[model samples]
Target: MADPLPGDVIDRVEYDVERGKVREFTRATFTTDPVHTDLPAAREAGFDDVPATLTHTVVAGHQRDQRGFVDALGLALERVVVGSVTWTYLRPLIAGDHVIGTRRVVGDERREGKRGGTMRVVTLETEYVAADGEPVVRLEEVLIERGEQR
Candidate 1:
């Protein structure tokens, strides 16, 4: 089977309202849009609350899954290559919301490179909502960490 990188990992993160970290991410990442910073701007955008910058992902144990992908192939992390990074948000992420822990695979063909080179790409999807879980926001994050070819 595709047991190249055969380990399991879980990442846990929490987000809330009235924090400067969001604003800091916006500024550091060069996301100058007011919606990402100014609550007033977000309101104009039809958002009931401030929006989360695209980069503000809950990437905690992300690397752990990548490590598993490699182990399943019987190859080490030094054998692959990072290809791309992507994330999609189903709804606007506002403050004072918490997202639960979710699991995702390396996508189709996580370990397809064994000869020329490999792109160890993994896309993670997440959702943030009120305590009731109405699906307020959905996000898909892509992480690529290359490995070595033997």
Candidate 2:
């Protein structure tokens, strides 16, 4: 498969921040920060409402796109590994907020590994924006696909 251009959009997803789900995420992540689970505490912390964890955007963006993007590159799940992840938070995500996340290909590189395998490094950037068009958070992920020529 030909490589996607730098500005190519891979996929877009929309999600609603449910309070219950946010609270559940907080618990599962073992976050004791009340700003993520309690509305009152969040307000006291200067947030308008209960704020979801920063990683939630990654979770929402990656849920259904894992195979789609990998397969598009003729790679499978077993050969793909997360190389890195970075988040730039512009604004907090609150419960009841409607968000649209877009995944775009920012860069790509091919290299020959010492083991005689071809590896593709894909750099993708996902931006989560609120319904009002305010940027909530941005996630930059680097994924390494191995055995592309095996």
Candidate 3:
């Protein structure tokens, strides 16, 4: 496969935030916030429904795209590692919200490794938008792929 170019779209998926999923994610993450699992608590917190943890997007995206963007780009999964992840939350996601996430390639570069090989760094950005076209969260992730040793 050819190297992914900037602006290449990896995938787009729609995720439905269900109450059960929200509660499950909260418990799995060891979150003690009742607002994420209880409708009454969430209503008291000013949310229309149970609010999902900030990191719920990770699970939602992963669940929809199990192969991941790197794998979609045809990169060797064994040589790839997540270098960093940054999230910009524009709005809180709650149960009953329908979100559409689009993953795209934003940047790509290669550098010489200290160990005498090449290191490819890829930057991907995924924007999660609500059904009403409002932005919910923006996730920027950097993946590093190590080249073969000389």
Maximum-TM-score candidate? 3
- TM-score, per-candidate, Cα-based: 0.60, 0.89, 0.91
lDDT of each: 0.56, 0.84, 0.87
TM-score of model 2 vs. true structure? 0.89
lDDT of 1 by residue, 16-54 (tens): 544476787787789878887787888898877777777
> Which segments of model 2 are wrong by more than 4 Å?
61-65, 114-116, 148-150
The candidate 3 region of ten consecutive residues with least summed lDDT is 60-69
Candidate with more favorable, higher lDDT: 1 or 2: 2
lDDT of 3 by residue, 11-98 (tens): 8888898899898888899999899988898999899999888888887555565576557777788898899999999989989999
Instruction: Order the numbered candidates by lDDT, best leading.
Output: 3, 2, 1
Give the lowest summed-lDDT range of ten residues in model 1.
3-12
Q: How many residue pairs clash in each candidate?
A: 28, 0, 0
Q: What local lDDT score does residue 54 receive in model 3, on the 0 to 100 scale?
A: 81
